[model samples]
Target: MKSKFLAMLLAVSAISFSSCTKEDEEPPPPVEEPKVYQLPGLYIGTYTVTQLPNLAPLRYVLAIEPDGTITTEGLGSDGKTYYQQGTWTLTGTTVKATYKTINRTSNEVTQSATLTFNEKEGTLTEGTWKDLVNSDGYIDGKFGKFTRVKDNP
Candidate 1:
């Protein structure tokens, strides 16, 4: 009888201990998935003109489209409209583009810019822009920090 009771108690203890398994303990913290960014989006930033040293910076919003088209339009505090239409290429961490800036009077000047895309920080940095054509126009400057505001479209 004692042997039977001892066997039954040991079986019960084994079943109870098995039920308290690592599975019953809190599940290992959910594995986190890596973040993916839709590259084509609105990059909002400012540009400081190299020629006009003391002038206010020009605010720029670059709309990068997936169709290889990019555009930007802005009205400076001096009441001049600045516009850019061009195509962009992304290789590794570098974003390069060449666009034509259309002033209010319809005078278009070609310009090119290069920026470093920082995926970790969600920003565009180490930017530089230059006028491809020396024609009278805007957009000869280094870009300020650019932040991705909208994703896609």
Candidate 2:
């Protein structure tokens, strides 16, 4: 009788220990997804021209829209505030702006530049601007670092 009682107690203890496991507990809560940011508004800031021989500084006010439209106004070395209307597209961290303008000589010109953005640091990676329509010359190896000043609604 004593041996039977001991065996029964051991079997019950084994069953109880085997049933209670880590898997029986509830799982952890689900993690939330990260938010995505949109870049479309007025970005007012200053840009420093980082090229050899001529290191100029310029202030710019750029308006961008989700529909790939852009308007930029800035003062050039010619002592005139130039206004340009163009279209822009953002691919990853790179932004490409294409503009069409008529010079004082009544010649229509088209230009395009690609600007890369550093989302982590909120800085612009300067890229080159080339004339697509007019093969006059190319502005090679230029850098323009810009920071946001105001965001339009």
For candidate 1, lDDT tens digit of each residue in 1-153?
A: 999999999999999999999888887889998666655888899888787799787788889898989998765657776887999999999999988766655455788989998776668889999988755655467889988988876
Model 1: lDDT of residue 86? 92
Per-residue lDDT tens digits for candidate 2, residues 1-153, read 999999999999999998898889899998976543356666665444334347466666667777888777765456667666789988888989987653334445576767876655545556556556644443333435666544433
In terms of TM-score, which candidate is strongest? 1
Question: What would the TM-score be for candidate 1 when compared with the true structure?
Answer: 0.87
In Å, residue 111's CA in model 1 sits off its true spot by 0.8
TM-score of each: 0.87, 0.58
Off by over 4 Å in 1: 137-139
lDDT of every model, 2 decimals: 0.82, 0.64
Any runs in candidate 2 off by more than 4 Å, and if so which? Answer: 1-36, 45-52, 102-105, 120-122, 134-143
RMSD of 1: 2.2
Local error of candidate 2 at 118, Å?
Answer: 3.2
